[model samples]
Structures are given as C-alpha cells and as structure tokens.
Target: MHQLVATPFGGRGLILRPGSTKAVQLPLARFEELRALASALSTVPQWLIGPVRAQWNVDLTSRSVGDAILVREAGPYEFSRATWEINLGCDLDCSICYLGEKKFEGLDMDGKRKLLAVMRDAGVIWLQITGGEPLIDRDFPESYQIAHEMGMLLELLSNGSRLRKPHILNLLRTFPPAKLTLSVYGATAETYDTVTRRRGGFDRFREGLEQAVDAGLNIDLSLIIVQENAHEVEAMRDWARQLGVPYREYANISPTIHGTAEPLPSQSPQYLTNRAPFTGCPAGVTFFHADPFGRASICKVGREPNIDLIAEGVEGLTRLGGIAESLMLRTGGCSGCKLSDSCRVCRPMAKVFQEAKAPLVNYCQHGMR
Candidate 1:
C-alpha cells in the first residue's frame, strides 16, 4: 500500500507511503537544502520511491486495502487540459512574439471538430483557447460552445481587439470563463503599439477589456517583458491593480523557434525568460496543447508531436499519458530554488528539454525579487 507524506521542511513536500502526516519547520538554509533534494528527486524514479506520480502535483498511492496496483507499458495518454489554437493569424506583429514568425491561418470548423473529438475522448475537462487572435476565427464561439457542451471548463487568452463588437462580446459571454487572460503590451499607447506593432491597439484593448469586465468575466493580465519595456513592470502592474485583476509576466522566448508571423530578433535571455523552473508543469499530467497544424504538444510553444489527435484521435492521448512523464522530468533552474513549495516548474519546458538545459534559467537567476 502507498500513502502521501508531506513535511513542511520541503515546502509542499510529498512522500509516498502509508502513514500519518506531520509538519516540520527548518531554518531557511535547511529548507533550501530540502528544496534541492526534491528538485533532484524529480529527475529519477519518483514512483519507485513511493507510488504513482499524478499530474498537477498530485501523488497517487495505493493502500493495502485499495484496488490492486497494475504496472503497465508506457505510452501516449489522454489529456486533462486542451489548448485550442483558433487562428494562427494575429493582427499585430511583435518582434518578440514566440509565434510571430509562424503563420496565423485560422482553423476550419472541421479541424476544430476533429480536435474536439480527440479532446472529448481523452476526458479533457478543461480547454484554453488562444491564437494570433482567437476572435479572428469566425467559428470561435461555436467552438467554445462545443467544448462547453462537452462539459469542459474554458479559459481564453486574447489580445482584446474584437471585444468592441457587441456580437463578439455576446459570444464571449456564452461561456462563464474560468479565467480570461488579456495581454497587456504596454501601460500607454506608444509603448503598447510599439510592442504589438499595431496602430490604435491600446484603445481597442482597453475598450475590449472594459467590456469583458462589464460582462463579468474573471480577468487576468498577461504581460510580456522585453528590453524596451522591462522598466514598465511597475506601471504595467499598476494598470492591472486598477483593473482589479491579477497579472502574470511572461518573458519572451525565442520567436524564431516557433516560426511566428513576423521576423524579429530573439530577445536576450536576461529578459526573454524566467529562471524559476516550475517542477510541476501541467503537461501530459493535467494539460496538453493541440495546434491547428495537426500537431499535439506536451506544452504550448513548441509543436513537438507526442501524438496526432487529428489522426489517431483522443484515444492516442491515453497511449501517450502524462503523469509518469511529468514525474520523470526534473524541474529546471529549480535545482536549488527556494519557491519549490509554491512554485510549479514549467512542465512543458522541462519535458521538452533536460534539467541541465541552458534556457531553464528562471527569474531567480536574473536577481528579480
């Protein structure tokens, strides 16, 4: 039988075995040591140390009284969360956009249905829609309705260009979004337009956001920091505060890697990415991404195909399951991180690259407090 044992010393530590739970407080120095140990364990056979490692930081264990545990061959698995790229097309061409150099073609309804069928079969209960602009896809609301009808929770990431259209806003209102993440290019039009490379974008984004809030959607701000606007962090954060929404800052990854819509030099690693590698990436575990290109990835940016949901269908996902893989991958840059307890590493990044990979450096490495 297996059980879960978490000790406070490890800051959200998990030990598998049958036993009662207790808490322990250690000096910050000792806590750091435990964090390192946990990060290391992420690389090896975590299951052998206890029971199965589930996704989203869940540790699955069997009890002497529970069902028999079966060991099976490893294969692609079903998805828990699905990312639907409505349109590869975007209105703005940012120099640092990860998908900027990539094409922004929209997905047809048939493609959307095929992807949804795959997700439905995989028992994916959650869906996140993103794009050059999801609103650019005429059938987006229909797609959302399909996912909602299938009982999947929905999250949307948009640039806020189309929200000014009452019908579009009405369509958006169809789903009580679990969360709506609006990308904030800058605090002011000059800064915002510069990043989005679009004229009058700040106005549209602001108006759309107000409508979204008026529609009673849970809003979150997504900010991308670059050399040009890095200093605007406080200002951007203040804007989010004014909107009464939480903000998440994403460092730019190499845009060339994803073949975005426009040609832009890759941002420097100093501002391009974060150093706090989350040990708990939700890939294969709790989430997965299916792009319009007919490729399914463990993460969003890279289109590495673990399975083709379009071809093999969602059943192909179960064949390439996630929990086990997530456990095997070490949390990068998190080797000696202090936020282990609260920080969940980018599972998608860790899964694609090794813990020792150079890009794993997170914010901690940049001297950010």
Candidate 2:
C-alpha cells in the first residue's frame, strides 16, 4: 500500500512507496476504495510492520516532501476541478474588480514551494493561474515551470494585455497548450475599455489575443457580465467561436477575502436572478480554495479558514465532516428549502450563522413558493 503526504496549499499531492515515489493525480479518481484499503491495513499497525511492508516498494514520488514519515491521507485528481487565482495583484481598475483594495503579500518562490507541494499532494491535475494579470508578475514563468515539472495541467487566466509583447509571446510558447486559459473582457475596444475602465484596454486585449492565437497556444476565455457589457455576451461568444475555443460568462462576485476594501455592491438583482441552477457548490469537494497565506477552507469567497491546509492535510480535509456535511454547516439557508437545487448562496452566506451566533439560517432557497 502507498502512503500519501499533503503539500502546503491543499493542492498538489504525491504518493510514496518503499523505494520509489512519484506524483499522483489528485482527488483520487478512485477514492472510495482508498478508505477501505486503509481500514484493512489499519489493524496491522504501521509502526509494528512498516519496515516489513517496505519490501513491497512501488515507484511514486509525491511533490510535497522528501522521504520521511508515512502519510496516509492523500488523493488523486478530478479533471472538473481547477484553481483560478494566480496572484491578487491586477493592473486593470475595473469598477467591479473586487480585489482592488486587498493587499497582496506577493507570493514568492518559497510560497510557490508550498503551493506546488499542496497541489501535488492533493493530486490537483489542472491549475488555473489568475491575478490582476499574471503576465505582470516577473516570476510568472517560474511558477509555471513548477506546475509543469510536477506534471500538473496548467491554465493561465490573464487579461491578455501583455500578449502583444514579442518576448512575452515567445515565453508562453514553451508551455503546453492544454494548460492555459485566458480572459478577454470584450469583443471590441469600446466595450472592453468600458469594462476595464482603461481607454486602450480593448485594443491591447485584442492584440494580445491575436498574438496568443498566432502562437497556437491553447486558451479559454472568461467574460464578466455587468450592466454595460451584458449585451456583448453573445458577441463575445461568437468571437470565441471564431477562434475555435470555448467561452463563458461569470457573474462578478465581491472579493472580500482577497482583502479588498469594500465588497462590490452585493451582486445585482439582475445578475442574481439570472443565475443558473446551483450545483450545491463544489468547494471542499471536487475543488477547494486556499487563502494567500496557505489557509485552506470551504470557499474561496469565504476568506476565513474553516480548515487549515498546512496542518490538516488531505486526511484532515476529509475528517472535517466530509464535504457534504461541511457544506451544510458552512453554507447558509439549507434548512427547509425544497429549491436547494437552485440556491446560489455560498460560504459568504455562512456569515449569517457567524453573525447571529447560530448554526444556520432559516431562509428558504430560491423558488421556495
């Protein structure tokens, strides 16, 4: 049996056996049996028989740590999951950008180690690097290299403003295409500038996209829907279609956790009303978010640490009531709602419990009537 050790960020994971260790995809594609295996072996008491067990070595080196203690809590990956934040810093001053006020400690190389360790330990196969704009970071490439080295899939979420630079374009060509995701704010300069609040942003974004496309890089586009650009969604979709890539709109949510000074005015009714049926939020389940400081928790938007990535490890994450129970305790308004399938509240709503000193809320889900 292989032992699993967790890395720093609750992402990245590694599996270790007697003489060999290698990276394993995370969230463990076949986790149901893992627990049973652990249970079956638990009776043997690892300390009493660990050395004997070492004779049956396998080759899997986890990214988190060197050979040390046996870690039983690890998982492999589930492709549907992806992390979308690279750094908190961004150049665009869009009115809706919620992370603007938050302070970025500036993730350094060591932090990258923690991040890589976590993702590798978690078996997170794909990481989506995002930020104010990832290209602005001088160490962006270094971070990319680490993910690539760990064999984790990579995707970059950027404003596409830096693509016009030949050097930047050249640098990007070194990576695999299946691992990148880009953000295009608008289909045209007028619309782009309106959303970015920068006069030349549209042209820059377009120029960058052109460069990326020319380089034959794999890219996905994300659009933020707002009053000004709501109508542009179809146009942007058509443009993405022309590029032979997929595009989607994400409603603007406040960046309170990123340390932004003020949350974007609670998402507008229009945006909220149009939300698609909720999938009960996959936080702490298929995917989890970590605070800049390496704290792991149920939701990226929630900010506070419901679970600590560094201390708990993968086993800790599962022991914390598992995802389903944790979601019930951490989420709001799940008491008597028949429309649970349509509710969109996340950890932020958990605040209702925190503020009222209650365990949960009494509200009904959408379509309660």
Candidate 3:
C-alpha cells in the first residue's frame, strides 16, 4: 500500500508497498503541498490523479492511493515515529531476548530529557518507550510525562511485570500512554516461567494485565514463538481473545544487539523458512532506533550510529540521508545474488555476513551457501 514515510536525511519518503523496494523521496514542503492537494481532491478517484501517481510510481488503481495521498504528514522533522530503548536493565531473563545479557550504562535523567527533546523537535509524533523494563527506570515517569506534555503519542513496550505496582498504575492514570504492548511468554505458568526463567512471572503478568484493563488502558499482546513455547501458541491466542484484547504472533528471532546468535537455538526453523522474499527494510528510510545511551541508528539490527542525540543534537540526523542512500544500494555478497526475490536476508544481517563472514543460519533458510 502507498504511504508517506520518513527519510534518513530528515525528509519525506513515499513507499509504494509496506516493504516494497520501490519508493520516492521528497522534501518537506513538496510533500506537504502534495498532501494538501490530495486532501482538496479527496472525493476524486485516485485513477484520475494519474499525474500525481506517476511522479512517485504509485499504483493508480490501488485503493490505498487516496488514503496514502492524505497521509499523516510529518512536520519539519520528517520522521513519524521513534523507538527509544530507555534502559537495558530487566527483572526477568528471557532466553530469546535480542538484547542478550549485555550491560548498558544508559544516559542520566538530564541526558535522557535532552534526547527526548531532540526527538520531539525532529517531528516524531509517535515515541515508543521501551527497555529491559522501562517501568524499572526511576526516570521513566518524568521522561514519559515530558513526551506526553509535548503532545507526542507514546507507546510502551514492556513485559508487564511492574504494571500492577501502585506507583506505576498511578503514573499511567496521570498520563495514560496511547498503547501498552506486553510480550506473553506462554499460556500456562509452567511454560511461561520456563521461557522467562523466572518464578512467578506468569502470575505477575496476569496481574499487570488485569490492572491495565481495569484502569481503562489500551493493551496489545504479542507472542514471540520459540521452541520453548511453540506448543502453547494456540492456547495463548485463545487466552488473549478471551480477554477481548488484540494479539500478534512473531516467529523470526534475530541475533542479539552484540551480533551474537545465541537466540538461534530457540528459533523454529520451519517458521523462518516460511517468510516472504526480502523486499526492503524501512530502517534508514522510514524507521529508526535509539539505544539507551542516546546512540541512534537506522534500525536496531543496524547498530552503526548515524547520530548521537545527546552529543550532536538534531543536526546529527542530517547525516542519515547519505547513510540511508548507501544502505539502499545492494553491496557485498548480496550485490548480485540470484535469490534476491525469495531471499529473507536483510541488509543489516547481510552486512554481518560481509564483515564477519558469519552465516546467519537461522535468518537465512538457504544457509547462505
């Protein structure tokens, strides 16, 4: 579907499909003008806007064209959303966590505030507050409040262990987030505790969900399917449905932030094999990730920092445009691979191959042989 996205260089990008390789870039003023014109002719059929569609290779007959034309326009900053890992300290130890056991010395309260301000100024309307467990951070309330006061839609990613706490619930009541996404380990306490390797995790998770729902908070649940909990997939979905809450399922498990494939052992090979071809990654194009220390990159897997929010401020974002462009160009072993259409190998993972010559057996079904 056609949609307006963010460019690495703090500009606008148009994606013809959600993960399609075809896209176009436009400056903020031009994008704004196009959106305005699209809104003015909202009732007209998209096919009638052939001239506009042709400019960006948009499918004229696609139903999403009109909706995309009048998309949420990013302000001067260009990026619509930002995922910030507020901290790396967690209460539970999940064997399949992408971050692994790497200790992160996050920014202080003032440093975090500066990073938030930079993100807000960049026109990021949606800020995802995540962490090893964001609720554990003493500065989480203040940082969350700052984003909320700035009128940014905030989404919290958590394990749901602390949501039952009186202070945590009080903070949420004061400034409710747009949504809270909790990761469900398993359907039963036995399986859940086995996956998380923590006693009483399932009980705490249930309590947290109950608290959030009772407080009238929107909640979304996700299951990261692994060998440890694959058998409980159906049961987990049924449980979520019974709660009348939305749920999603994920099968692919990538390496840790330190580029270690420790989580691969838990991944379901069949699930990884069923993925579609590598269309493109919206990393430098429409998405970005920032670690706890204020280092921003194109994506979480692509750890090469394009900007240091605390040290360089918003000006650092300007360097991302070139990085994004460079990433778009196929290079290394992927430059002329014949399996491009059916290959699930993404650029960041491919970079790992090119640099370390390590085969991501779990990520690539074909074994990259």
State the lDDT of candidate 1 residue by residue for 1-369, as single tens digits.
Answer: 112222221223232222111222335453344345444443223332233343223333322212211111112343456787777778877776656454766457898887776676665645788986888778887887786655455788888888889888886675466778888878888888887788999899889988888887778888877766666778998988887888898764442433332323334345554454444455655567777655677666435546776777756666344434644443644466555554433434333333223333432333444
Of candidate 3, the 10-residue stretch with the lowest lDDT total is 13-22
Q: Candidate 2 lDDT, tens digit per residue, 1-369?
A: 113322312443333222122333335432333334344543322322333345334223221222322334434543224464556766677766656563455556777667667766675655666675777777777777776556555666678888888777876776543545676666778888877778998888888887788777867788676666776778988898998876766764544444443334433436544344445666666666655555555555554545555555555556333644445553443555555565555545534333434322222233333
Q: Candidate 1: lDDT over CA atoms?
A: 0.59
- How much does candidate 1 score in TM-score? 0.64
What would the TM-score be for candidate 2 when compared with the true structure?
0.64
Residue 54 deviation, candidate 1, in Å? 31
lDDT of 2 at 250: 70
lDDT of 2 at 82: 43
Q: How many clashing pairs per prediction, in order?
A: 40, 32, 0
Off by over 4 Å in 3: 1-75, 270-273, 352-361, 365-369
Question: How does candidate 2 score on lDDT?
Answer: 0.56
Query: What TM-score against the true fold does each predicted structure earn?
Result: 0.64, 0.64, 0.76
